[model samples]
Target: MTIASCGSVSALTLGLPNSSAVPAEKATLPKGLFVARIPVSAKTKQRLANDIETITMLSLLRPSNTRLAVGTRIPEVLAIGLRLHAKNAAIPTDIVELIAMQRKSGIVFVCVRDADFEGTKRQECAFAVRRALPGRAGHTPTFKVFVSDWKPAGEAMLDIGDPAVDSIDALWESLCSQVMLGSASPTALDARMTRRMQAAQLAEQIDKLTRDHQRAKNPEQRNEIFTKLHKAKNQLEELRKLEA
Candidate 1:
């Protein structure tokens, strides 16, 4: 498995043969495994519309039905394929809202497909992991969401024909790493979220400052805006470095 970093999101490339041969409707898991075709309720679709332009299909992958009893810690896993209108579609910014709409407890992997002006199909895949944090007496539980970048699609197909337990275990293990299920500490994950938010805020601030600097006629005002923009950019770069 090779991971390529694209800004904040990382693309996972599982070097497997015949991955592209399988159709989207086919289960990626080995034959005889429990792959259920679950319905995407109208209400769910409407909620997802906030972030996604269109949803093509949603399927549930249950490890409990397998003979090997994999994914003991995870209750459910979702595979979703979406069609977006945006040419360069990345993971949705408000992914937490999309997670909140889910009734099950587990990770979500999305395959986004869109076409350029030439009508050539382009696909990208990403994963979203959510962890529930303990809340105060009166407050509801808060969730920590970790999203990967939309990478070129291949591993997202998950089309594994091997039924061997070792193969399945290795596959699940790779997925577990993506969500940082047991590998990452809560404090570490929280710090990541903080940095992500800070970076977004700083980027927005820099954009506004740049516009203000451009509009300002007075040399002193322009100089002040430039100073602020430079500071914001420096802070954002530090945050990106930390993420890397």
Candidate 2:
């Protein structure tokens, strides 16, 4: 999943709000800024392993009384952050499980980070949206999850030395734009992932066929390999076009 760039604004420039201004040692968020400081249990921490040092819920956004044109309320949005043990630590992949544990719905803004170094920090921030899948008769319902690319945070603000209120507000606006535009909808991201996987598999198959064609002593075997190679190349080309 990757962030769909908007006009002249780069994705990284509009990444999640830097939590550097929020002290790491304290779980408390800015006064009157957040809704609550949801606790992270020891068992949950164990499940995440040492990859994440802490998980903090900064705020929650709910729909207002006003209804939309669709006559439905906007989904709830959760702003959360995870402090990682190191820069290379894996970002959490089990978003569904995480959301289920929290008993929350709708969109999630995730910010995963490592401690600062040389006045710079390593972070991965993205928005994850969940969609319910249509269930078959007598079958259980499932869900499709879409995640925007984990964009680097605070690069443009590095020289600023500290997180400013305006910068933080801008970050929130960028995040809101993503949700409002539906840029990271499940169908679009899922299709892109499927195309990428197909392209990769085709490339690997073509490479193997090329090697097999060279090693084949029989003319018939070589011709068969060549045919398969041609077909794979065409398929790959089609996928590339879809990507573009």
Candidate 3:
């Protein structure tokens, strides 16, 4: 992927064949991934652009067996990017769509935790990414770092844990190490992800039943929905317990 000027469309370029033609298990190379969103504060926007640039440079220098070119950028590429970065403001549909995009491109996402997570957000976000694997929603790997920790340190002389982030060269070295580690171990997550996926499915079913209950015009229909809703609620409770 080549870096464009800030606010310009970012494009991902991989050296591998079009991923669609190859079986996924055989495609071991990595693709650059960025998530941007609308209505971000100026600080967030600048941070996003900087991060994208860093990813672009890293992608360009990526090793031969490790760099995979997916394709040229499409218009909705930015929208999918937005969805991944929007977090709480992003709905399930947006997340589902973003997951689809990542899966299709065989790219790994990079995300930040909340603003208050401080230097620990990178590890926290990494765990979150690992936890997301069982949903079968996407097939992309993710590497996370704590970029939300920017508060003018003034003259405090900070004791930064990963000083590599202080410059692009150092940061790329860290990222390359991460990619070499490969995707989160699906085997380790299998049992947990299975339970989590079931819980998610039950939650979605409960939501649908509640909506149906609200939309039912007749008392008979409403009663039917209520019965299904009650059953779904119980099932969801069980699923949650299993996940826990």
lDDT of residue 40 for candidate 1: 50
* Clash list (residue pairs), candidate 2: none
TM-score per candidate: 0.45, 0.53, 0.32
TM-score of 2: 0.53
Model 1 spans with C-alpha error above 4 angstroms = 1-104, 112-187
Model 3 bad stretches (over 4 Å)? 1-51, 55-188
C-alpha lDDT score of every prediction, in listed order: 0.49, 0.47, 0.34
Model 1, residue pairs in steric clash: 9-149
Ranking by TM-score: 2, 1, 3
lDDT of 1 by residue, 1-244 (tens): 2322222112223322322222334423321111123445565454455435544224444453333345454454444444444667655534334543445544444546443535675556666555554345688867665666555665443432333323234334344345543232223444565576678899999999999999999999999999999999999999899877
Q: How close is candidate 1 to the true structure, as a TM-score?
A: 0.45
Q: For model 1, what is the error of residue 33's alpha carbon versus the real structure, in angstroms, after optimal superposition?
A: 21
- Cα lDDT tens digits, model 3, 152-171, are 21210111124333332332
Highest lDDT model number: 1
Per-structure clash totals for the candidates: 1, 0, 3
Q: Which 10-residue window of candidate 1 scores lowest in summed lDDT?
A: 3-12
lDDT (0-100) at residue 135 of candidate 1? 41
